[model samples]
Target: MAETEGKFDFAIDRGGTFTDVFARLPDGRERVLKLLSRDPQNYKDAPTEGIRRVLEEESGRLFPRDQPVDTALIGWIRMGTTVATNALLEREGERTALLVSASQCYPPLPFPCCWPCNNERISVGLRSHKGRKEYDLQRH
Candidate 1:
């Protein structure tokens, strides 16, 4: 329960460049490890190896001889990875509509209005814009 805290805990963070693991013990001490990310295979394997090494070292230091850490002695084991790569590359974002003032209303799309949605491709009303506006629609 909340009153009882785990003796050992683990948490991980996976980023584009590296994977990080953080482990803490009831003794108010912690260990951190960073590993290079591997594509396709995910970034957990590397951190797992790192955590194993840390556990071994801690076990040796605490017991002096060969002793296994009891499961109950561990607090929590957390793992996570960053999976935003696809979304970043695809540029797939929220679906929303843009409202333009009457002065700069035009088929926002690069070319003329198509069909179906006829979704405004590109609208412009700003005077700073190089393109024509509603008033100069006939100019260009």
Candidate 2:
């Protein structure tokens, strides 16, 4: 039977609260690294430092001294983010329009509603509104 050769691999995970890493070398040895997540700034620096440490430790574990490691191999990257949702929640979403039925244009305006307050709450097409009629909401 042919001798099975081992492989080297690395994995990093960044979550809302932590960063985790795992690395393995051809010699069947592995290393795990973890660090607390710092919001905003850490998002940029933590991964880089984690990768540097992994490389240093992996080099010593598999290729002691001046050994040339293979440079060609499979690599994977996966990223999940909540930045968009956060931005929207922060009221940074794009300007949006609301379409309300003409008849119910203004019903005392719900307090603290998601729709914009500065503009007319109700909007309808020319044909429909023309055929129908407009009544003073204040009177009704």
Candidate 3:
């Protein structure tokens, strides 16, 4: 095993059955580690343990129990998930909301539209709105 001191970049993928890690050490050496996913009776630590094991292998020392891994030398770490894909495949993720345009109702208005008197229930799309706001909302 070659040892170097500087910075490192790593990527980790945590899947349902395994965890894979790829790291680039300071000495320009590439390291790879794969571990089985595990969830004990009360703790889910597969991803974390996998990273730790990889780091230990690269550093040649067991990480301290009280302190976190030195992240300063870590250039970047990216994470991803297949939860949405799995949800779609399994027919899950049903929590969703639909936005109804006020103009889509009965008669279409040509000018600025006025929403019905539902002061207590109004959702503002912040993504579509911006700038300072100074106005009073009243149900009319």
For model 1 the TM-score comes to 0.43
What's the TM-score of every candidate structure?
A: 0.43, 0.38, 0.53
RMSD of 3: 12.1
Report the C-alpha lDDT of model 3 over 12-105, residue by residue, as the tens digit: 7777676677787777888877766665752356556655665777778776534577666567676655655566556566433323355453
How many pairs of residues collide in model 1?
Answer: 8
Best by TM-score: 3
**What lDDT would candidate 2 get against the real structure?**
0.50
Poorly placed runs, candidate 3 (over 4 Å):
1-5, 41-43, 65-67, 93-140
Q: Write the per-residue lDDT of candidate 1 for residues 30-66, one digit (tens) a residue.
A: 8988877664454235655556656667766442123
RMSD of model 1 against the true structure: 15.4
Candidate 2 lDDT, tens digit per residue, 8-98? 4666676556767776655767777786656455334454455555655655644322344343421433344454445445656543334
> In terms of TM-score, how similar is model 2 to the real structure?
0.38
Give each model's whole-structure lDDT. 0.55, 0.50, 0.58
Each prediction's total of clashing residue pairs, residues at least 3 apart in sequence or on different chains, is 8, 0, 0
